[model samples]
Target: MFCSDDPVQLQLPVLETGFPYGELEELLSFLQSDNPTVSPNNSGSEGSNRTLSSPDDRKRRRMMSNRESARRSRWRKKKHLEDTTNELNQLGAENQELKSQLDYVASRFFAVQAENERLRSECASLSARLSDLHWILLAMQNHINPR
Candidate 1:
């Protein structure tokens, strides 16, 4: 097994009939070959005595990593959806409350307008009665003084 700090060095290049492709194929063949130092029985041994990791092992690890990442992505999306639903419900309730307030205010406004109209009619009637009384009082005064 070769260990390197660079990711490019760690990855196996695609197999094409190019300058680096032949070299990569040779390297892959060598890595796929059995280890001469480790026997077949020792290959199954635990811990430090384990054989070098094969391509299959790397593929499995990569698959598991991708699966876990996908699960986490789904969880985040579900949480976001729930939070959005809750916010929408809260907004709807607030809107309903505001509408109720508007209705109450409108009803009060109409009541006040009706009272204002009634007061205006009453004022007009009172002014007419006052004018009639003033005319009657002037006539009585003329009859008493003859001037």
Candidate 2:
């Protein structure tokens, strides 16, 4: 097992097909090997007691790990998108409901305003009729008394 006490780790170049180190023969063998144990979904780490394997083996393991990480990242992104979309849909529905309530309130306000105006008009008409009757009563009283 190679244990590094250094804080800064060395960066390795990611390779897709060809070997970064000039080991064409090892690369060919690694490519031909159908190892189902190197599945991307395999979560277990190579044991803590793992001795330094060949470069091809390390590269293959790294590639598998990278693929698994990418798969998980894509899954998280998809889930986040779904949750956001659902929230947006819910907010849209709530906004529409609020707009409907506002419209109903506005209509009721207009109806009340119209009723108030009608009542004011009726009050003014009644006031004018009462004033006319008071004057007629005064005139009749003055005529009958000759004052």
Candidate 3:
């Protein structure tokens, strides 16, 4: 068949010739295959019944289990590290935001205090001026009437 200009068909894996049932079937069958036998070399019913295990078999099992456990633990640790990094970044951003808010509030509070001080000083000065004016009026009235 002449090649069509479809992009979907072009991205497929290039298959090499001369394999049993092609690579796809082999891959599918392998993925669908059951777990391996516990004892691969041992064959007969007597072999099945025997309790004897070779040192090599035990070593292989131990190594496989250890590697699997280590691999899983490593991936888990990687996930945890990534999570921690994300949390720390979020906390840092929040902390910075809170700090900015605090600074803004502090600056506003100082401005208010300064305004209050200025208002208090102005009120005190006005009160002093009013008292002086009252004293001057009383002196003028006493001088004018002799009582």
Best by TM-score: 3
RMSD of each: 12.4, 13.7, 12.9
lDDT of 1: 0.69
| Model 2 per-residue lDDT tens digits across residues 54-93 | 4657787689668757876888899999999999999999
Please write out the lDDT profile of model 3 over residues 1-147, one tens digit for every residue: 223332222234646533446645654444333222334444676454433444555665578557656876888899999999999999999999999999999999999999999999999999999999999999999999994
Instruction: Give the least accurate 10-residue stretch of model 1, judged by summed lDDT.
Output: 1-10
Which parts of model 3 are misplaced by more than 4 Å? Answer: 1-53
lDDT of each: 0.69, 0.69, 0.68
| Per-model TM-score on C-alpha atoms | 0.57, 0.57, 0.62
- How many clashing pairs per prediction, in order? 0, 0, 0
Residues 39-137, model 1: lDDT tens digits? 334435542533345566667557855765687688889999999999999999999999999999999999999999999999999999999999999
Alpha carbon RMSD to native, model 1: 12.4
Which pairs clash in the backbone of model 3?
Answer: none
lDDT of 3 at 139: 96
